[model samples]
Every structure is written in C-alpha cells, then in structure tokens.
Target: MKEQLNSLVLKYQQTNDEKVFKEIYKLSVAKFHPTFNAIAKSLRASVDEVFALYEDVLLRCIPTYTGEGNFENYFMFSVKNKRANLYRDRKLRTQKEVLECCLPKDDDTSAATLEIISEETPEDTLVRKKRADQRQLIRSLLDQTDETTINIVEAFLSCERPTPTAIGKTLGIHHMTVIRKLEKLARNFDSKQFGDFRDYLIAN
Candidate 1:
C-alpha cells in the first residue's frame, strides 16, 4: 500500500499531470466510500451531501499528502474529521434556525406588547410550543420500545452520527440487525407523529 501511494505521489510530482490527480482521487473515493457513506447515514444526510463532502475531503487531502505511514488510513481519518465538522455545522445551523424562528417579526410594532413578550414573539412562541409537542410525541414513541431498540435509536440520533454498521460493531450485533432495528423504530412511530421524517432511519 505504501509503495503504491508513494508511486502515485511521485508520478504526480514529476509529471505534474492532472490525470494522476484524477486517478488518485478516484482511488480515494473507491477506498473510502464506505467510511464516508456511513458517516452520512449516521447524520441522516442525503447521499449527494455525503459524496460532495467526500470529494471536498479528498481534494483537500491530496494537496497535503506526505506519503508517510498508511495513506489510506490518513485519508480516511481526514474524511472522518471533515464529516464530524460537517455534522457540527449542520447542528449549529438547525439551532440557529430554531432561534431565528423564535425572534420577533420585523413589523411587530407594539411597544407595550413587546415588553410583555420581550423574549419571543407570538409566532415564535407558537413554533416552540409545536416543537415541544413534537418532541413529547417522539419521546412517547421511544418509551414504548425495548432497551436495545432505545439504545439503537439514540445512537442513530447521536451527534457522533455513528452509522448502523458502527453501532452494530459497538453493540456486538450484525449490521443487518442494526438495520432491522431501525426499521422497527420507523414502524413504531406513526406518520403523523414523525411527519415527513417518519422513516428517517431507513431513509438515511
């Protein structure tokens, strides 16, 4: 592996051919697709988003390759770190959206009323209440599940964004078992309770 990576690196360095870069990029994608795809599945991101991130990570890693140690391992590490950052950024964006939803409207021109509702506008209050209700419904659904199912579901929903495969490894179960658990979770929640995210685990 080391020799192959070194050869690729030297070829790119000496010839300065973009084709070498392209070849290396393809190799990287093929080798690390599983790792990156798992991260995406864990985060419940679309396949397109994960592939886009994989490409970005590959491009960034290629320019900085030192050809030391295991190139595949180093490359996978970089991709995983990038995925982690993407997850964090996504979570932050979601939080920001929720906060923005809670803010007073531009034309909320009632001074005394504003004083009474200084923290949040009526619209914001309603949005938050709705979110709270949804959360409660989800919690109720989860409560009906067994311990293993609960653990599997929580792991899927974690910030770490562990894939079903990763969760299976952690729980000493088969990857297919993890997938089945997720399907069961989807079945547990009604479409109305889950809204458009009804089959979230399976969809991801």
Candidate 2:
C-alpha cells in the first residue's frame, strides 16, 4: 500500500491531473478510514464530522505535499494536529459555557447543571489520558506477540470490513491461518476486556 501510494503521489505531482488526484484520494480514504473512525470514537464525535475534517485536510495538504518524507507519516501528523486543534476549540467552548452559567441569571439556570459542568474532565486532560492508555495497551499487546502475529494484527485493524478472509488476503495467508493466529493472540491478550478485538483495534 505504501509503495502504491508513493507511485500515485508522484504521478499526481507530475501530471497535476484531476483523475490522478481523485485516485489518490480514493486510495487515501480506503487506507485511512479505520484511523478516522478510531479518531471519531475517541473524540465522541460523529463519523461524518471526522470524515469531513479529513477530506478538508487532504484537499489542503495534497497540493503542498513535497513527496520528501513518508506520505503516511506526513498525513498522520496533520491529522493529529487537527485533532488537537479540535480538542482545544472544544475546551474553549466549554469554558465559555461555564462562564455563562456562572453569570447571574434567572431561575431557569439550575445548580445541578453547573455542578455537572464543573465535574466534567478538561478536554486536554481527557485526550492525554486516552492517548496514554492506547499506547500502553498497544505496547502490552506487542510485547506478547511475534512479528508475524503483529503483522496480522495490523492487517486486521487496517481492513475496512475486517473478516478473517480479508485479513488473510491482506497478509497473503489462508483464512483459517488468520483465524488460528487471532485465536492465539486472544489467548495471549484479553481481547474480551475491550469488548472484542475490533473494539480494541478502534480504541488504539
């Protein structure tokens, strides 16, 4: 996929053709859809909202992509920055709401509402803790597995509709082999703790 993306990116850069650019966009959507879904789940935002932001970012960055660094890394860095900006904006909005609630108002403003708002975790802190937890979980899983298993795990996570057959196809293995590997992974790590392997993948 990386090689394919690099080729497409270079072609687009050279041609500056609309069709080439569209193909690049299509490949990008397929490759990054899981990551976008994961981001939306983490932020407690709608998938459509996340996808819209992703599309906007891609449009803004593609023309400027110098094809110097790894394309995936460049794209992901932009995504992380955008997610951070979103959290910052949310924090500001929450602060504004808190201040508005503190202002003297009519009987319509309830103390319970103020208490709830005050008790909520700050957006930045929540995002930090979530990312930390995800990293720790990924590390723990990696420690318990071999490189082949890790490859399977990654392929499974990357699939838009992650079935055993799809994962096998991605890794050039049999479907039953994919299942066996997953079962072994499940034994090594408590997949059920995260509701299922799919949920664990999304969380991470």
Candidate 3:
C-alpha cells in the first residue's frame, strides 16, 4: 500500500496528465465497484442509473485519484448524491406536462425523491455536526481567554483595518505578546482536524 501511494505521488509530481487517473482507476476498482454499486442500489437508485452515475463519478474522481485509503469512499458519497439529483431532475422534467395538465399550479404537490436519497451516511452527518460544534466551541473558548487574546483574534478577523497596537499595550505587555498569545490560543483552543484558523481570522 505504501509503495503504491509513493508511486502515485511520484507520478502526480512528474506529470499532471489525466492518464495517471486512468491508471489509478484500473488499479483500484477490482473489489471497489461491486461493493459501491450495491451500496448505491441499496440507497434507492435503480441498478442501471447507479452504473451510469458510477461512470460519471469515475470521471470526476479521475482528477483527484490517488493510491490512498478511503478515496473511493468519499467519491461514493459524491456519486450517490449526483445520481439522486440526476434521477430527481429528470423525473420532474419528464412529468412537467402531466403535472401542468393535472393542476394549473406553479409547483408540483409531489415531494422530490432527493429527500430520500441521502449521500451522507448518518455517521458522516453526525461527524460533520460534531466538527461544526467543535469549531463553535473553540471560538467560545478563545473568547474566555484573557482580553488580550480576544483582541488579537478580533484583529486578525479584521481584514482591511489595522490591528491597534494599543490592545497589546493595554494588556501591559510587549507587542509580540499578541503574536505569542495567538499561537498559544491555537495550541490550546483550535481544532487539530480543521487546523487553527486563528491564523486566518480575517478570512472569516
């Protein structure tokens, strides 16, 4: 596995060519596709539509192909959603005339099938929620630090405006105290999974 990943990284570095993706597809799809197709069909898509979407997914994943674990897993999430969207859109469009004839309503009474076709597993959704909560928690945590920490973080958030040196001076500390505290804030409060974005407060 390590060797294969190394080879892929080398290939990626050597050429940004699409053939590397084809090679990755050829190498990785032996046991992956059948299991993937089963998962998609289980999610309510028809077998034929699942396969068609699988082809499209392979093309999408091609650019990001790598000999890495769970690459296919992420792509499966994306492909399942794409398949669901395609099916829903096509179904709605095909029935447009019938729908118009049945009721002169602007919107159809029927609900979209996409509501049933969830691309994210319950675990994935929970993980995302937990991560978001963690980030919010981190922000709150930073707020509880000394006023200097809060001021520094707020300054970083202000993109156009200059950070007042007086915030540092008001703390009765050196100018570098702000920078050092920012690093400590990241260490103690920021998330490892998402990286400490105190470095990019202005980006918020």
Candidate 4:
C-alpha cells in the first residue's frame, strides 16, 4: 500500500495529474490520521486543527519527496516540526496576553471603561509596540535568508532543539560549520536594525 502511494506521488509530480494527486492526497490523510490524532491528543489540540497542519505538510513536502526514505517518516518529520512551531507561536501569544493582563491600569478615571483605557502607561504601550516591531523584524530577516540557512535556523529553533551535530547530519554539513553559520547569522542581526529581536533570541 505504501509503495503504491509512493508511486502515485512520483507520477503526480511528473505528470501533474489532478486525479493521481487527489488520490495520493486522500491516501496520505487516511494513512496518517493515527499519527495526527496522537499528536493532537498529546498537545490538547483539536483534531481538525492537527489534520489541517498535516495537510499543509503534505502540500509542501510531497512534491519534493524524490523517493527518499519512507514517505511516512518524511511526512512525520515535516508535520512534527510544523506543529512545534505552531505550538511555540501559540505559547508566545498566551504569554503576551498574560503580560497585557498584568499591565498596570489607570487609577484616576471615574467611568470604568474610560478608566481602563487611561490606566495603561506610555511605557506599557511602547513595550507592546516594540515587541510587535521585533517580531516583524524577525520575520523580515528570515525571509531574506537563503533556503538552506532558513531550514537550519528553523530546525534549531524548533522544540526539539536538535544539537548542531544532529542538524548538521540532517543537512549534510559539518557540526562546526553549522555553529559558525548560526553565529554569523546572529551577528548580522544588528541591534540598530533589529532592535529587540537579537535580545529576544539571546534571552530565550
């Protein structure tokens, strides 16, 4: 069954056959449902959300599989890394919301709603704005990097935090080379241009 699906993926990549692609996609969803369900259950995520992430992983990776290792293993690695990033983003949002809730409020205003608005300090507003700006800078810089560099950085940033050696093995580079490239990348993030992004990476 897996070999048949693998052939279908290759054929679809070659011929761009809508029917073959659809069949391969359907088989992928069915074949990986258990994996997705387990991840969703462990993360306390909605199954539908997890499945959507799985589908996205398929869209991005299937065309590039090239008959490499087990397709299931390849797909699993992609989806797992994607889920880790999703989890991290969700965690950051929750932390931001908690911080917002803890910000000091205004004391002098009489109307309750107006009082709430008046209570937030200029410093609090600046802090939130700076964070938003820093995130934008991070994304912009990530977009500017080469694909291989971006891949290495994303793998490093993922929840697994795979060692430089492990990442190097996956990317077929020397471990010291990976460390050097990351260090150079970090140095390129000038504080004048990136503001708190460099600090955020270091602090984390």
Ten residues in a row with the worst lDDT in model 3? 96-105
Candidate 4: 10-residue stretch with minimal lDDT = 110-119
lDDT by candidate, in order shown:
0.61, 0.63, 0.52, 0.62
Give the local distance difference test score of model 2: 0.63
Q: Write the per-residue lDDT of candidate 2 for residues 73-123, one digit (tens) a residue.
A: 677688779788776766666566652235446776555333334544576
Per-residue CA lDDT of candidate 1, range 47-113, in tens?
A: 5577656654554455467767766677789877977877887786556553222444575763323
Worst 10 residues of 1 by lDDT: 110-119
Candidate 4 local distance difference test against the native = 0.62
Instruction: Judge candidate 3 at residue 168 and give its lDDT.
Output: 56
Residue 37, model 4: lDDT of 70
In candidate 4, the residue pairs with backbone N, CA or C atoms under 3 Å apart (3 or more residues apart, or in different chains) clash, namely 105-119, 106-119
Pairs that clash in candidate 2: none
Which ranges in model 2 have alpha carbons more than 4 Å from their true place?
A: 34-38, 99-204
Model 4, 187: alpha-carbon shift in Å? Answer: 36
Candidate RMSDs in Å, in order, are 15.3, 15.8, 17.0, 14.4
Report the C-alpha lDDT of model 4 over 1-204, residue by residue, as the tens digit. 778888887887778666786677667765766676777767656666675566556755765698976776677788779889878866765555422233336755544332222356565787667656555665666776677677776665542335455678888986555544654465567756545323433222
Residue 167: error of model 1 in Å?
A: 34
Candidate 3: global Cα-lDDT?
0.52
Count backbone overlaps in model 1: 0
